[model samples]
Target: MSFTLAIVGRPNVGKSTLFNRLVGKRLALVDDQPGVTRDLREGEARLGDLRFTVIDTAGLEEATDESLQGRMRRLTERAVDMADVCLFLIDARAGVTPSDEVFADILRRRADHVILACNKAEGSAADAGVYESYGLGLGEPVRLSAEHGEGLNELYTLLAPVAETFEARAAADAPEVEVDVNEDGEVDADAPRKPTVDKPLQVAVVGRPNAGKSTLINKILGEDRLLTGPEAGITRDSISLTLDWDGMPTRIFDTAGMRKRAKVQDKVEKLSVADGLRAVKFAEVVVVLLDAAIPFEQQDLRIADLAEREGRAVVLAVNKWDVETEKQQKLRDLREAFERLLPQLRGAPLVTVSAKTGRGLDRLRAAVEKAHDVWNTRISTAQLNRWLTGMVEAHPPPAPGGRRIKLRYMTQAKTRPPGFVVMCSHPDKLPESYSRYLVNGLREDFDMPGTPIRLHMRSQSSKNPYKNKKKSTPSRLRKHIHGRGGAQG
Candidate 1:
């Protein structure tokens, strides 16, 4: 029930800039260059205590022909439809243009709520441009500089009521759900009900150049804080930004584009890739962004495999969907290919989006939240043991030293990919194949088909501490044997 706010504007109008301002991070790529952003990115945005989901949309353009621009426009239209409130932004320095008018008309017709923003209104020179924005006829324009971060208070005031109303409605519709873990790390089914809001959702955004990774984040944040360019490899660090997504607190990590190791020659690129790896390691859910035209490369597969190995939930995002043709067939083919090539992550959610246009961003967020939910799931020890009994009965363990090792007890040690520990007679003697079998069984039996399962075996040893300390020899026995033999003779 998170409220959603979308920032929509034509290219280079500071939509990403506004997004970054709201999210309080330089997560989106910011450049003076036009058409730098290409995707709709969503983030958890907070203004004072008013928290909600925010989307940074790609700059819109008029495209009636079956071209990339057309796709971008379609994507923008979708974002406007889905948003609870739409912030239509314009550059106060450059004055109003036809693109702005077209998009404004679209927003007026489609969006239920609209907030007109005159961005880059830092000086008196921008007053003319700001005044011209009144022609769009949305409302009194909130003149603010996304670059200088001026006039944010007015923006906050505008959004607070909308957010509060949304929260009230959500609370009324859904009963509170509480999750509790006992001393032994098992969830109590009958725990007292409370609202869910403790751990922050961990999300990692990763992709190749110009795939709109930074743009998407900026759009969600409502600011242009990150440096963006048309050139490849602009981001060299995995930057983390914490915010509220539809009232859900989340930490989103923006990572560098992963390339084939063989093709990586520069030291900077290597460092960037390494940093991205670290992000993947720490993230609970990884969103793999792909250019729709070149979706699912070998390197992409490698990255996805690495995430699986690290026990992270993965969400696949096909970026630049606005530019692609044959969308349905491509999505189907990519899914099939993923299943064939990376079956370990079967049923991993795939989302098609325009990081530039903000299309399918809400769905992307939903998919990520779902993946995270599955990732954090833990099974009860009793249930696990029961499942293990069935599995061991079906396929017995291999004998070691002419004796079959007995598995005495089992319990889930940790979650976030679900690790378990098993007590056995000989832990070291357990075969690799048997371990794989148990992992597979747990995955299949527990409805955790795609998630990685870790199984560890520990042996029990019993020994006395104070048994053998000192020994005394019977020395007189040898002398007595010799004397007795002589006397007898």
Candidate 2:
């Protein structure tokens, strides 16, 4: 079950800081800038023994009735409605302001459970503000320095009860249901999980600065809609452009160039890089544009690795391909370099195209679609089992401490990178080498090379199908009638 908790607060109140803290990574872009987080970003979070999803929302601000801020506020309110709880953060140093009071009123009127937190409360100076937050009527404020990782334990304790109650309510309200996945790969009324509306397929164009991200988008758009320049880091925020590719809705994002981590200095640049990463996370397909002059840099490999780890479909587009004289050699070298550098994304579709010259654009689109198709590929349980049997027979699971590992049933639990769950005797006892072998074998057998494959092993106890049935007894009346039968109730 997935329960969401949304973090809401004014701008620069360390909401993104706390968001990153809870999600256990830099999933949200954090900056001193007020509105760095314009979109509601959701991530899976773990607090103590509780696991739920958390959403980092845009800052609340006053806006004209028909302004962008109004729309953003509407979106934020919608996120709050979607969540099971709301964490309203206030700047401890600045104390509660008029805007905070307004937000408090809104939360109090709507939200049943609101956890107020005094952010940036590191020293005695914040004590007064923390006390003032009690006026909001949202119970005792959980003092926290989101940047310094303070007051999380108290926050967890407060959340545990709420989490438990939410879980209980969910279980009680949930319908008694069984799912039957049909052969057509579509879910019927009995399906386990039903997805929401399938929106446009997201494609992110990412590479070094001046790799023609905006130019690529402009070319595809056939207009100079996005700002293009020879300057680096020209585009800070990721801009999403929607279009139709063969009648299928597709959204392409033009992101800022991601430089090597060692060189990242300015606060805005850092935020921009983080935004690019978030775009990658949300994308289904990533077209890594490469400069013809300086292709296959270390940073490019790192970015590709990030995409693979995120289970995104990857397409390597060699931008400025028209300018290169040694086309065949460059292509070969690029392929060879990618194979060596990013083996996880090996065999990923590579196309040579000039975003400036509009050359090979069709091929780039075709490669992207192909990669997307591969990413969504799924295999049957019976087929997977057959392949598994063959693999174990050919090179069986290795044994450590003289105990042979017993791998039982295998099934593809989910698609979108083709995740499989294998039932084994001891999952933790399985060596990494053996796991890699099975994953590689699946990739090879299914002809899904370069597509990220996740194989998770679990230790499950087998159960008899008739374990729950009660034994029937013969009746005494029937025995009397039949003379030689046993007694029954």
Candidate 3:
């Protein structure tokens, strides 16, 4: 049984600090500047035998229009609505401001249960601010210093009761199940290891700024879960959500837009880009979203190449397709440009989509599933050796220094972006073009297009067994000869 707690307050009041402390990890990005967080990041939190989900949301601003701050405020409000309990934090050192008072009123009217906390209450400097917090009429505020890790015991005391109530409610609402006992008088709990309904496919949607990443995810979610506007670089964290995508269990990540290295001078943007890179590394499949009007730019090619180099199964998506007038020609040109620019990802699926209209998402999903399948593909040693024979017969390896490079044996070393090892003579002499040929053949013959394939060439040289053994001495030989002559006599 679990409940969700959303830490809400004005910007730079230590909401993310308290969130990190409660969750026992730095999952949420924190900085000295205000408004570093723009998305709702959720993590599992534990405190003194109490466990729950904690949401780190954007700061609650006074904006109510359709601007970036307004959208962020709306997103924070959504978090408040979803959470079972709300932790409204105020700056104890700075004292309660008008903004804090306003958000407190909103929480009072919105949240079912609210825990008012005065953060930065570590010394006498914050004493006056702590006392002034009583004017808001929420109750006695818990004195907390999230950075110094003080006052969490009191926070736990307040949370224990609420956690108990939620636990009881969950237990009552849960469906009953029967378990079978094995011969050893234990419950048979072993399950299959294959991907099933319980396990979800991990997919990360990544691209440059203003590429409609957040908008696309929102369309899939059928809600404005993330803050989005005409502004570039609105997202600064890799926000992930789980759902059944096209009847398949999936956990998709909406990552921050990546820009050229020279243009990213801010520390927060650097952290954001590093976070997105980490998301790509963890993902089994990466979707590189491109704007249809300007598809396959230098940055786009670099991003796709980055995914390929990281060994992530790649899927190309051209966004804002509805806005394009010459659909057929544009798609053809996009394909040609993709193949020419990213020859490594020659046969990868390229789908066109409109994040605003929710078009071609189904095809995108299918392409992702297929790429994942190919990424995890495993071929037998027998089939691989047979294919290697055909490849060698068609175009034999080059002979460097007049010695033929015999292709002896082939076997798959691993899967998940299938890697193959080839044992041959003078493997060091194999040219790059020849290696590319073998790789392309493996991709075509093995039906593993677009997925990166690893090919390793090694020389299988036989070592002499007696090379290091010392020869018998002349004295021992003479003694043996004398003994043989005496025996014969």
Candidate 4:
């Protein structure tokens, strides 16, 4: 029994700030710059026992052409249409402008329910603007200061009735069913309750700007859910969507393209890059999209390395493959560059796809599934000990200063990137090369290619029972000593 509420208004009116407050996280990038938010981001919102979905949309503008602002405005309008109620906000200190009036008219016509709110009304500076909002002909405006957390109680009061109505409707619409019980007052064993299933896998799609990330996602969804164009840096927010792929539930995040730190001079772009990094951290598998014609650029390598460092299952997707004329040579070049430039992600699935034409999507999905499986792989203690024995025999650990480092036992400490702990003597003396050797063996022998493996060496000193006890002289020695003393006397 949940409904969606879209926070819509002109730019710099604190829509994102309010969104962050409602969702209890900084999911939306917030800055003083207008038009910073270019996509619709949704989150679960709760306030005073009320639960619903909240959407943060781009600022409403008066553009109507093919400009970026115009596209952003259209996207915001789509969010308004999907939302159950639209919270149209205006800067209380600045008062309502012509753009606000125009957008208010649009929301009045589009949204079935609308809640007018005047934000930034923390002090008397906004009093005049709050009083002037009555001229809009909508209802009373809720006084709010999103940054300072003011006037939220009034908002909850206003929304309680709407939430009640929704709950009642949902309860009435729910289907009714009957269950049978035996005379012993127990339910029939044949009618077992269904087991709960796990949530969908979280996969994030990320790369440099204009790498066809949005286009690839659109191809998968078979619709234009994400806005796409030839413009670079079109996507500014990391948008997540859920879908069913071949009977498997999967949630995918489309993140903003990452650029070199030196090249990113704008504040909004910095926030965008930070948002993309957050998405990678939140995701279980990360798809590093690359332009097929120019694969493995410095920025591309950085993105892949970042993913690997985050311990996410990595999959390389070379987009726009349909335009490549020399397929075999290009693929060979890609593989060579991948191996040479980024050995950290060696043997990771490098999938080539044409996002526009929807080519090789199946292979990409399969590779993602495989990478996730490998990332979550676990090995039994027996198997790990056996593997450790063979590895040590093949390449015994180095002994510095003639003191041999004893390798005792090995076991997997955890999964989800497969961490292992090896008990040995003189763990501090273990070299990095030996650790790499064991990790590579685990990857190759365990069929865990491209998955990050953690091997920890622990020092286990052998205990000596007699070392802590006081030593006593032997009886024979003591008797001999006494006899020697008497003979000397």
For 1-489, candidate 1 gives per-residue lDDT tens digits of 778998989899888777888899755666666765555667789788888888887678888665656655676677788889999889899999987898888888999999999998998999999989999999899988888889889998998888779888988899777977678986665332222445577789887656778878876676654545566776666767777777668878888888777889976567667877888888888988888887778887887888889899889888888877888889889888888988778778888888677889899888887777667677888988888788778888988779998887799888777789998888898988899888777766776656667789999764566569565546798688888999999
Candidate numbers sorted by TM-score from highest down: 3, 4, 2, 1
- Predicted structure 4: clash tally: 0
- For each candidate, what TM-score against the reference? 0.54, 0.58, 0.91, 0.89
lDDT of 2 at 139: 89
Q: Per-residue alpha-carbon lDDT of model 4 for 1-489, expressed as tens digits?
A: 788999999999999999999988888888887888887888889888999999999899899888888888888999998999999999999998999889989988898999999999998999999998888877999999999889999999989989999999999999987978778996544231221225788889999999999999989998777878889999999998888876658888999999999999998898889989999999988999999877888999999999998889899999999999999989988889888998877789999999999999999999998898888786788888888889889889998999989899998877667789999998998999889888888888999999878889998878886787988999999999999999999
Q: Cα deviation in Å at residue 58, candidate 2?
A: 20
> Would you list the C-alpha lDDT of every candidate in the order shown?
0.80, 0.83, 0.90, 0.89
> Candidate 3: global Cα-lDDT?
0.90
Q: Which candidate is the best by lDDT?
A: 3
Report the lDDT of model 1 for residue 138. 93
Off by over 4 Å in 3: 177-198, 464-489
lDDT tens readout by residue for model 3, 1-489: 799999999999999888889889777889999999999998889898999999999999999999889989999999999999999999999999999989999999999999999999999999999999999889999999999999999999999999889989998999988977778885423221234566788889999999999999999888888878899899998988888886878888989999999999999999999999999998889999999877887888899999999999999999999999999988889888888889999899999999999999999989998998888887788988888898889988888888879999999887777888999888888898999999998889878889999999988976788899998779989999999999999
Best by TM-score: 3
lDDT of 4 at 55: 93
Q: What residue runs in model 2 are displaced by over 4 Å at the alpha carbon?
A: 1-198, 462-489
Positional deviation of 19 in candidate 2, in angstroms? 22
Worst 10 residues of 1 by lDDT: 189-198
